[model samples]
Target: MDTYSTATLYINGKWVEADRGASFEVTDPSSGQVIGVAADAGTAETERAIAAASDAFPNWRAQNAYTRAAALLRMHELMLERSEDLALLMSLEQGKPLRAARNEIRYAADFLIWFAEEAKRIYGSTIPSSRTNQRLTVLRQPIGVVAGITPWNYPVSMITRKVAPAIAAGCSIVVKPAEQTPLCARAVFDIFDEADLPPGVVNLITTSRPSEVGDAFLRSRAIRKLTFTGSTAVGKMLASRASESMKRVSLELGGHAPFIVFDDADVEHAAKGAALAKYLNTGQACISPNRIYVQRGSIGRFVNVLTDRARRLRPGSGVDESSTIGPLIDMTAVTKMEQQVADAVGKGAQVAIGGERLREDGLDGGNFFAPTVLTGVSPAMSIYNEETFGPIAPVIAFDTEDEVVAMANDTEYGLASYVYTKDLARAVRVSEALRFGIVGINDINPTAAAAPFGGLGESGVGREGGAQGIDEYLDVKLVAHVLGDAVD
Candidate 1:
């Protein structure tokens, strides 16, 4: 792979070093080597970026929807033109397989395309007035400058999901990309610059000082909205702080998704789906299945097929062509996987296949864990109670439909859940019963550029993908017109 470097803050359409010349090294989690350095932004830079966005908001909001849509379309073209490079860069920094990285680039670019069309579709409505001499109308307008805080898991996609909609809605934004993956954010901004977006319309600030920057965002009155994608703890803290200013907020937080396989489901098909849902991106996604429930009658066959699929996964560096699963983000992730497995085993959960980290081959220096399947996982085990953000799938057996649905909805975090069944009535019943923001009926991949992606409960608030996505960056105003005013 070629060495890539993008170590600067992008503010007001220019790439500049941090104010104090502070920098932080970015390491490849797969190889434990410093890939590049990113500018370490502070409170001052964050404030400046916020100010820039605020200054540019009115003109951006004043532009016709078609003009903004054209810019987004150009960005979409640039992203696709550099798809391979973006994929390689993401793979090098974030440690996902090159193939998966390529897919993410496509997914990221699709957001720009989707929102480009959606920009022109921001429709308003006219309502009948109660009084005879009055008319009523509803208008959707830009919510002004926005602040986006994205995570490292899906670096490219997360940024586009937030920024594309904001831009499409005619709002200027200041983005704070995750410290672990600032290059991807910088790369996206490069596309924006090449697309000829106006100065101050989009700003990027790479920072090691998250809280300082976040506090600056909260304190800035010019920022009207704040959107975030990260852990639940961090989301809650930011939400609490933003409350002081009553800022509009949207968050996509942690999830403990449940994958259910009923007896009526095709055992082989269910197992394949389970493997894909559980181990994609090495199970680092927020929507990854944490607890898998199989009907008592199909548990044996499901376990056999699932274990075979797990054993076939080739864990290696993300850039390696033959690798199927890549390393976890860092040592902390490895430690969490270790602790979860130890707790499950201590509580009498039996490991069906792999139960340890993969220290063999060239994976010792990086954070690599074996794809594991635990058969006897129960409520007593910590794996059942906590979110396992690694490649560990714990299978729990249930006999009744009510039991499975209850078990699936037991968690406080309700982001996503999956149900597999051939019976139409049962599928509908179970799908309606699951208390999640998104439900997959015999489908592991339910999210797309046109769907509403968000969560219920502690999983966070607001939607990110569909028509509702643009609404997050907009404000509704009801206008009442009198006959006398119309005459004048």
Candidate 2:
């Protein structure tokens, strides 16, 4: 509770109280309890944060990549040094297990480390000119003043994912984290000050009114790029707003990824992969497989194995050592899952294992939903089309490869898809055929700091992470100059 009290807006490199001086409480989803208060920002404060980021852009961009890299290295070290404390804080507010939070911190820190090195390698190309005397040098320059709009599902890693690459590419940013999880964002920003990040290089604001903050970013010419991670509907709205100014937008939006298991694959490994893909983050992840497609021959065995694994999980507070399944971020999330599950069941889906909300003595009033498995889910059900961003795995049976591939590509989202098979040729065929931006063949974890991550179609625009990640924050400039005449 004391930790949330200390949480405040970070602007121009200072911890600030909201101009209106009003604050809101951040709740612990596991206990349905208020953990801490955060300063509630309005339009004025949001504009100030933007102004600060815009003001700091030139100086931060002027620094050499080596200097920037060195600062990032310091930040990386601090994150590692304070990993335990940060993870516990995250677990309290985020409702994820302490161990999971710890792993997220490590994963988040790896971005800092990877991007720190990448900072020094913003390479440009020298192109040959048709005219011998003319010289052409293609340069990559930072797209100034980025705005990061992140979701609550991954408080630390998501911020690091956006901020690290932007910083590495020499772009200053103002971030607006989800209202539910501002404490984790503030904790990460605390390290920025200690790492000696210049004032205005990074700014954070929390507001109940997201529209005000979004309008400020969209309308301001100073904010060159906007990066968001959330639902597809919101992403579409943001993109529409950004288009008015022709502001660059990078959106990591919603997904209903398909986990396709073929008859020829190893059933146990495929089941394990399904659990890893669908149940991590309690299936709040956008890339979590919303629908599982198994060939008729494999469907029954796969369900048995997956349910056996899911039954091992206990939905409880993150404080419990044996608790692997934590509460959803809020009641809203729990309610949504309830609605989706109901819709599926109403339409003939059968629950294989857990289904009802968990309400044991210790779990009462908390946002805990049993990790569920549903069979006989068809395309007619809403769960088949909509992303059930919960701990429910609905297995849909299919008969043929062509039919399954068509079913997998049926959704508007093309974010991520997982395929499990032993045949190298089949893996290649499916991987090439999937319309998604990311396809995991025989593996559930397809994302890394060194790999480009994002999706096609409604899943959002642009890529984040790897060398391509920094590219989004940069603009390509072609320099053409007349050189001395070449000797014949």
Candidate 3:
């Protein structure tokens, strides 16, 4: 075990250590072991961090969009230069494969630059007033201090999903990255420093105790808005707390995205898509498709091809360059996924190809599980109702478009869904019927900086990507200026 035990927090545009000087272990999810310790912040530290962000908001928000965009552009450039450093850090902490982490870093930077360009593009229009003497227009203004709570999975991207747009829109923020994967996210704050965002504009705090950190902001009047990326359970709680203060909230919560395979689709391609989509980041992603529904004619071929793809996955530590499947983020996740597997099997699901944890190979004693495939899965199984968040693909068969669509929409989550069909009509039909904010027609991964992302139902309110992203931080106010006095 490596002996380094402390990391820094960035608050008010400066790197810091907690006042009590306590540190908590940072485990490598890839190895089920400790890699380092980060500063453990509590309410007191959170208070200070909030003040920093609150104090900086007026000045930051008053600056021109071009200035904010310039900083974001510079940070984007630095991010590209330091890509390897951040990506490796992300993998080491988050337990995702290195390439996935790298892709997130690049994507996170894209969020920054994309929002930078969008910053100046926040459009306001002149209202046509019937009154001869009055001219009315609307202008979008920054909302004030924002509190951003990001999750461990896709830590870098989630942070950028909030921070980049908030700052680009001229809102200051206090960030609380998930304890499991705070380092890389914290390091990205260094870019803010390099970009010279005004003092107290953006702050980062590492706290193992989320309730305490969260409550601080929840109770604070200075924090006008809150954003979260996590499970639906916690998202609701956070929303409730923020409600007391009537704070504006944005939640990007959980998903059990349904992957529907129509009989008309190519089975091989669908199988590959299902395998990759289900197992990406060990399926910890909220957008990750966990429920696979194949039509009657396609079920046999799809399962056979999918199981083969799942079986081919090699499990190893995130440190290993060749390893594709890494461990879940922590021991809790391992336990959770293990129970999910047992529960599914106990409920009569059949293991198709790879089903158990992998044998620990060498140096690091990796927490590796074989890519698992479960066939004959029922909607009542835990894997369907709840998210497994692991490299497990459970295939459930359905007949007819209406049946599949009903199966897809039968969930509280409306985050994302996938449908594979050659016919454009079927693709359009399934896409419209699937109750998700984002849907994949032929593509397994359906996301880009240019498109708006988020969901329709309990998944979350409001969108996060595209030009609409920065809109979350903006407030439109009607300004009525009298052009001239009416001559009777």
Each model's TM-score, in the order given?
0.98, 0.98, 0.96
- Candidate 3 clashing pairs, residues 3+ apart or interchain: none
- Best TM-score among the predictions, by candidate number: 1
After best superposition, candidate 2 residue 7: deviation in angstroms? 5.2
The TM-score that candidate 2 achieves is 0.98
Location of the lowest summed lDDT over 10 successive residues in candidate 1: 1-10
- What tens digits encode model 1's per-residue C-alpha lDDT throughout 1-488? 22335446989989888987888899999989998888899998888888889889889999999999999999999999999999988888999999999999999999999999999999999998778788899999999999999999999999999999999999999999999998888888889889888899999999989989998999998998999999999999989988998999999999999999999999899999999989999999999999999999999999999999999999999888789999999899999999999999998999998888888898888989999999989999888988888999999999999999999999989999999999999999998989999999999999999999999999999999988899999999999889874442
* Model 2: number of backbone collisions: 0
Model 2 CA deviation exceeding 4 Å by range: 484-488
Candidate 3: global Cα-lDDT? 0.84
lDDT scores of the candidates, listed in order: 0.92, 0.90, 0.84
Give, for candidate 2, the lowest lDDT window spanning 10 residues.
1-10
lDDT of 3 by residue, 130-180 (tens): 877888999888999999999888888888889989998889999999988
- By TM-score, the candidates rank as 1, 2, 3
**Model 1 bad stretches (over 4 Å):** 1-6, 485-488
Q: Residue 69 CA error for candidate 2 (Å)?
A: 0.3
